[model samples]
Target: MHQLEADALTSPRAPSFIVTLYGDIVAPRGGVLWIGTLIECCAAHGLSEGLVRTAVSRLVSSGRLEGERIGRKSYYRLTDMAEEEFEAAARVLYAPPPQPTGWLVTLSEAETVSTDWLPIGPKAFIAPRRNDVLRPNAAVLSCDTVAGIGALRDFAAQAWPLAEVGAKYDAFLSVFEPILAHVWEAGAPPGPEALALRLQLVHAYRHAALVDPRLPEAALPEGWPGGRARALFVRGYLALTHAADQHIGLTFHDSRGRLATATAATELREDRLRRECLA
Candidate 1:
């Protein structure tokens, strides 16, 4: 209901798909989805019942989900671990567009990259976390905590590599541009098609977000298209909230009450905020 895709409910695996189902449908209002409902929904996407049964068994064995038996019915919901994982993932998955506040990385020669942060520069890799820093050799010049403006384009090129990640953005824009255009044409007021498209857009954009390094606009190659992609995503999703709400109502079987309260669905929801790949 919160601009997530049921088909994309996970990150391209059975477990991830289950995670997506939990996060997208179950976690929103902190409720459970019945086994039958889940099976039916998954079937709509061509997931066989046997696969669903296997995935559920695997998830329960790993403690990511808990199955509950209520009288003659069965249901499933997120376990604490899944809830925590989804919470962390939701922050990144629904993050606002990239706004890389330039990082100042000081490259000191290191013998090993075993530290919590990834080593970059020379033998090191980029820092894994935004706040991570390397232990200094002390023999080198004092490091600057902020990224230097000089040759940032080159730094980005060497570090993040424009070819693959840049292609990801290009692919995202290619798919979404037409969808956004259609949203403009259809105007406001949501419909089933809009909701379906919005979920699809979120799913596709999430994949791109995972692939992109999310470098600062200044550091990226000339004619960077992330801004365009973000703008298009924002436009397409906002216009489709009506459609998403329409969907939730129909899916949940309580059409009027949901429609009345669905007003809150348009709160500029976002995920995957960090330029994590760059950091």
Candidate 2:
């Protein structure tokens, strides 16, 4: 791993760890957590006292977190907006993706065209999930979607960068395959290292998935790697679940009930998706 990546995996100062702490721990347990609890959690990730303390202050000033003090002790909680944001993100991160039924898009016309997300020869953009058509000074047309466009295959090929997404999946697989090989051992769960490693692993894979629009398996390029990657992620996470939970129990006394609460909240989110969106 690069120095940056190695540090990210080990350090609680990383945004990824903060996200993990908020999403996996705090959000589930009702958005309120002690500053000391957060510091201790970060310490378990091998971060120093000052760095974690600074991170909490930064998050508070940025309005993503709110801090409260009682008798010289500090408590922190997710701001309402941040809690809502992370709740939505967790659904996308954990649940199966919905196939793109109707695309939301914007189009532009020009004498010359820009590079990103442009069809071959570059006329307009279909405005994929990540990329959009933003011209400097041009008339633009936008729509929810043109339902069931004909010759969809050719159009999809022109609009989205499926090959690039495939390559990202491949990269994720290559990096984690060796690490996941024995993630699930026969007997007792591994210790704190396993918890840190698993969180880092989830964060890395989640980053890859977020960048991807996650097109249907059928529409993807030949030999797409996303399926294998998701499978590995789920399987690897399951393997570490027990160990990670143990770490949580051992390290943070205040964190009790957070995981169970988070699981219930997650089920509610997933249930809504099953009824309203997936169905």
Candidate 3:
């Protein structure tokens, strides 16, 4: 004759908020936050319910989270592997760059702009359109339209298909580091001109690689790159340039006469990153 046990279950919010909060908790490699507790915690951070749910579903599917059912309640926590991986990612995200001083804000207000077309060197516009003459420097010379295509070709030639892609990332970053260093050294207006061109190319390649969908579109031109890897590469490439336009005031003038607005979020991030605007 034991009395019936009272049930303990937390009310559910929008699936999206749940997922995103779960990710925030797990992403820092911290302790498991009870689903009930997490809702309150994340609400303060302004995460939406939809984003939380989406994040949770993604983590579960990706094997980053585990749930334990207890009567009417379920408790979820990050797995050890997820903890390790997420912590590593977090370290990279917050890692301090060599130059902590901000120097990007001194450009004239007129110099700051964002647009759809890629900004190019007058040389790129005037240089003979001979694609054959472009030599591979693996760093400073890599451009979005051509250098990116060559990266794919180099990747294809690798014994392990992804090896050259990894190499390309290393090479590109190596080039980017020096450009950033110079900016930290000389400030914005007088920084080496080569620094801007190199930054543009790197930015272009990064965005071109990452801006596209994670899934390949069937309609891509003949000899299309496929699979998640290629899609992610395209996304990175596009996102880089998008960041520039939104933050650094870059305008892209493509074959078509059109302009795309820079994202306000990008501008905010730049405010934090650039020396001139830091609060």
How do all models score by TM-score? 0.66, 0.66, 0.27
**Residue-by-residue lDDT tens digits, candidate 2, 61-110:** 88888877776677777898898778666765666445444333334454
Give the runs in model 1 whose Cα sits over 4 Å from its true position. Answer: 1-18, 104-117, 121-150, 187-192, 253-279
Q: Model 1, 56-174: lDDT tens per residue? A: 88988998878887767777777888888766555555553346554434354555433433345575444422332344443322232255555767876776756776677788787
**In model 2, which regions exceed 4 Å deviation?**
1-13, 99-168, 185-188, 253-263, 266-279
Which stretches of model 3 miss by more than 4 angstroms?
1-29, 42-55, 97-279
Per-model lDDT: 0.56, 0.60, 0.35
Better of 2 and 3 by lDDT: 2
In terms of lDDT, the best-performing candidate is: 2
Clashing pairs in 2: 28-262
lDDT of 1 at 76: 75
State the weakest 10-residue window (summed lDDT) of model 3: 1-10
